[model samples]
Target: MARQPVARQTVARQVVASPVLVGRDEFLALAGRRLEDAATGRGHLLFVAGEAGIGKTRLVTSISRRAERLEFAVLRAAAFPGDAEATGGVLLDLAGDLRRAADAGWRDVGHALSARLRDPLAAQGDPHRQRRLLVQDLADLLCDLDPGRLLLVVLEDLHWADQLSLEVIGRVAVRLPGRATLMIGAYRSDELFPRTAMRQVRGRLLSQRVAEEIRLPRLTAAQTATLAGAVLGRRPTGSEVAAIHGRSDGIPLHVEELLAASGVPDTLADAVLVRARALDPGVRDIAAAAAVIGRSFDFDLLTAVAQDAPETVDRCLRELQSVYLVQAGADAATFDFRHALIRDALYADIALPRRRQLHERVARVAVERGYRDEFVSAHFDEAHLPGPAYWHALLAAREAAAASSHREALPLYRRAVRNLPDGSSPDFHATLLAALGAEAAAVDENAAAAEAYEEA
Candidate 1:
């Protein structure tokens, strides 16, 4: 799940209204002009970034609505928090749009897209030319979708997007110049630091100087009060506003959660758990298992981790949805916790032994399904099953190194060594250290390389 920047803290107060999007007049004005520009055949790339719960989605929804008012044909797609690996997952959300456009005479383009994206459920093809061809076709499709009206494509939660999805969007942004289209991407800024696939996407786009980025700032105390007033239909007392701002740090989601979860629990996790406990114990158990599995989890995966019958998990999910704890994903079989904070709370509240057990199940199921090496390794590490953890870590490290992400591979190799159980073969430690040393040397971290070599 996309994480909150702030440490766990209490939700502000117990109040509720449709989310009040305050203090973004300037951004909305800028967005309006960009839409007008798109209508005039001047395309744009707008990057909206902020920390979790800072109203990134609310702001973009506002932009989309404004664009609609201007008669622009808008298409929206969002990447699942931790499960965006399906091929063209974001673009595939527009399958309905593509079909409709086909019926309206874009048949050849639609056929081309269908052929290229024949198996949207599978991983994308690896060849550069294949990806470029698909991206080019998609871009042309966008321009032709509604030749007279401007087209607005909004990709949300990009920090969770797969590399192929990011690459496709980046390519579209570049090709949209002088076309009647606007591309907007929203991602968590806090998650894009130092090293991440999303950072690489941003780097390429920024280098081209083709996109304008707007980083949403935390709300000011005054703005917080306005937001609170709008939600409650009455201005807050001065003390209440101060409390909200202090606890929430002016992040809209935090403020909203705090307001809705009044009674002032000491931490956000506490508030979230309080709500979870209000649901059926069975439902809550399912939720905890889902969190242990991953934020964005499928029905089959949850059932496996829950060790329960499929029907049982489905019933629990229905109960959870009644409380707005989890919502069905783009695919009805998949579900996501409505908020990352809630998942954090549930996962954190699980007993250590139970967490280990659940993680072990997740690792076993992932290995059985031939899931990505990183996920398999991650669950094993969480399970603390030293032998399997160590071996999977090594595998994950090799995968990362093969991708030229040597810096990322280094820590995985270190994890392999750290998790080596007693009586392990001497060669195990030697091999792990050798891998670590190689990665460190590749990154020019000679001291690290020497240390690993000495240990080996």
Candidate 2:
């Protein structure tokens, strides 16, 4: 994409001297104007998209620092691959920033917001409303707190941002114009894929004219030299600059990593996988893992089954929360996939072998954690572990019978009988058959009950 012309005297020239900022003058100047517009109540969303190591983070830092000079309230956070879907991950960071910043704007907004954020969301039957309220609270607070006082919200690594967080940004962007609230987001363009949350939110915002995008290209030769010189604190020889530029390919992060090693060559690395078509690699992985656990999942169980860190599990839940693909359950610790179809979509993507492995993992973890016998038995069955499935099914059947749930006991008893291992003693088999016979008779399945009694 063609970048706008760099201003004659770039705002970047006034930025703190740093090698990364050398050829970044054009972007800084463009960002500078946007910041000015925001400060003057022409608030809106501005996205900076580029490859990893392309200086997005540095650019965000520079923009945030400049916003601070404009007396704007600045909130900054970065999303990681695994933690992008968390409902509260990014906001938690933002609120923490506010508290640490001790900004007067935050004081006016009150601690209630932060406390509420830390506390579990109240059980809401309407997750759509819950999500809207989530975005609205944060958006309205910044937009309405003090219109005269500008606010800057910087979210970096948005390529990995969760749906809820992106939703918040989109909602905030809608309220930015004439509100002195500028939301600056940086993301790895290389990471965005078709149907990804970033792509969808970004496209919609641009289409709505509530957001603009700046796509950063690698540094030019001369600009690369300038950065090399700045890092060396002296004029770099022509050969030296050319070598650095050649080795790093003008990617800012690569340049820094190489330069930091002094004369020795240093290697830099960047890698990630993405989506069920559009899902962020991290979000998609978590989704696939969550799907294997079943339609409904609790945070603790998901963590165990997903094998992702707890925070990542939470963030991904929020991402699914954003798309209405899933809904938080009656309590903070649980949520349900919005529908079986969506779960099936996620589930189908899992290869059969891995699917079985995941089912086994979920079953074992659920069993250890004292989940309902039925839940454990079903997972074990899906995992093809008939022994445990039968054991759990029997346990469930007995529990059902004790609770006077004869109909439920009938099914569970059948499951256990069908799963009996070939080596079980005849007497043992007959005992289960007799019990099944009695339960079937109690439920008035006359022929089936008589058949079971005859077998016993």
Highest lDDT: give the candidate number. Answer: 1
1-456 per-residue lDDT for model 2 (tens digits): 122222222111111125347667778888889888876778878999988767777788888888888888776766643333233445655665565556565654545456645442343645445545656676665555555677787887787665556766787778778677778888888888753567777889889888888988998778888887786688878888787788888886566545544362534321011113344556666777788886567789888887777767777677656644577863568777654444766787788988988889999998898876876877788888889989998997786554333445676788899888779999999999988988778657778889998998
Tell me the tens digit of each residue's lDDT in model 1 across 1-456: 211122222223333534657999999999999898989889989999999878888899899999888888777777765433244555655554455552555455455556555532233555344446655666665556656767898888888765556666777787677789998999999887554557887988888898889999999999999988887788899999988888888887677656666554556676677677665566667888999977678899888888777877887787666556677875668888876766877899999999999999999998998876657777898998888888887787775565445555776787788888898788977877888999889767799899999988
The local distance difference test score of each candidate is: 0.74, 0.69
Model 2 TM-score is: 0.54
lDDT of 1 at 443: 60
Candidate 2 lDDT (Cα, 0 to 1): 0.69
Lowest lDDT sum, 10 consecutive residues, model 2, at: 7-16
Which candidate leads in TM-score? 1
> Lowest summed lDDT over 10 consecutive residues: which window, candidate 1?
1-10
Candidate 1 segments exceeding 4 Å error: 1-19, 68-150, 160-168, 200-204, 309-311, 390-456
Model 2 residue runs over 4 Å out of place are 1-20, 104-110, 114-124, 262-266, 269-456
